[model samples]
Target: MEFSGCWRNILSVAIAVVLLSLAPPLAHTARAQSQAPASSTSNENDIRAATVLFYAAFNSALHGDLAPMSAVWSHRPDVTSLSAAGGHAKGWNEVYAGFQNIARLYPGGNIEQRDMTIVAGKDMGYSVCIETGQLRSSEGPMVKFNQRATNIFRLEGGTWKLIHHHADSNLNEADVSASR
Candidate 1:
């Protein structure tokens, strides 16, 4: 009877020791599972807000205002922009210069983004959208444009900033009008 009691106590202690040893990893896994949905929702919200900011900045650029556009961009050396007006621009200075030229030429416009899909990761995201806009040229003629555009963003200092913009000007007036 004495030997049996001692063995039972030993078994209980061994089990407790094993459980305690496994507790950290188990707790971490449970915490991660509980937080996963919240984290995903927060990331989605951030991505949407960033996309809205991007459109606002694009509109500001369309209106020939560089301040907002400047604010939205990452301004890093790796930043890049490619558009009909700017051809292909790389680096902050080159991209800014391209925007300057685009602003000068396009002046103001009403742009509608359709079929936009945004995917966000830990610190980066990419969006693809169909941009249809009518731009009033500096000379006062309205030029309609339809382009497939993709934009890449990076999270910097807790805000999403545009890192790359690539747009194609393949669609003509007829194509844009037809889509409308």
Candidate 2:
């Protein structure tokens, strides 16, 4: 990753860590704060839709399909991601490669975000949430996956494109290991 991309990834992960430390009632807070003027609401709704697509693609990626992932991510040079499965990627190509690796390491599984808090600006937005589910590990054991993630998106050509994703393994779940 470039220096700027590294910094953005760090900041995004730090924000997610802080959010994870907070109590679990922020869903309502997020909804209330997202209420705004018509234009802002439209943008927020668009962002939410992008998030939905992201997760759908995310689950698909886990099962060895990367085509859906292409639709939600920006084909940019600055995108970066640090996966909970233990790898770092910089730029769109590298990021997609990382997902390909994930598809290889995790051939089957499901992951879904919870208590996501969305913050949308005019051109950029981010989401902080917990990813919980079961993933069949590379060793063929289904493991509980409790992760804290932060996803950053950019408004590109009137659509929200995911520009960065940082996922950290949270071992709060009993006997949970790295999903890799």
Candidate 3:
């Protein structure tokens, strides 16, 4: 009878340990669910900011719309952009000038960004995806390219702005025109 009682006490202790271990995850899950709406709001805000940034790039490239571009960037000169050719453009002024150069070269061409994914953290977020566009040159037929890119954003004064951007084309000119 004493051996049976000892086994019962051991079983009780094991059950108590199991229950205690399970409590933290259950509490964590509950807390996460409670905060889910806030996370969702942040995600939506990040997506909107990212879309604006994409529009800024598109408009700056195609229509020379500096307003949209200016709206999505900080006035500070330290903002940076990394070109597809492994070149870096630092500061807002340099970045603006580079975009202008592309606009002047392309004239009436435009690129479209798609398949974007935006994820937000406490004060920062990342946007990643593919971009497709046509580049018209005075010397040849339209050139098209598909680029994969990642953009980092910082939230300042209740607005999210692009702090860094890096992009790379997936193909050379020879393969650029092939339909995917």
**What does each candidate score in C-alpha RMSD?**
6.8, 18.4, 4.2
lDDT of 1 by residue, 90-169 (tens): 99999999988887888888776776777877788888777877898888889877888888889899998899988888
Please tell me which model should have the higher TM-score, number 2 or number 3.
3
Residue 16 of model 1 has an lDDT of: 100
Which stretches of model 2 miss by more than 4 angstroms? 1-36, 171-180
Off by over 4 Å in 1: 1-37, 171-180
Q: Which tens-of-lDDT digit does each residue in 118-169 have in candidate 2?
A: 8888899888877888888688888876888899999999889999998897
Candidate 3: segments with Cα more than 4 A from true spot: 1-4, 14-29, 171-180
Instruction: Flag the better candidate by TM-score, 1 or 3.
Output: 3
Instruction: List the candidate numbers ranked by lDDT, top first.
Output: 2, 1, 3
The estimated TM-scores of all candidates read 0.72, 0.73, 0.75
In terms of TM-score, how similar is model 2 to the real structure?
0.73
Best by lDDT: 2
Global lDDT of model 3: 0.74
Q: What residue pairs clash in candidate 1, if any at all? A: none
Candidate 1: worst 10 consecutive residues by lDDT? Answer: 171-180
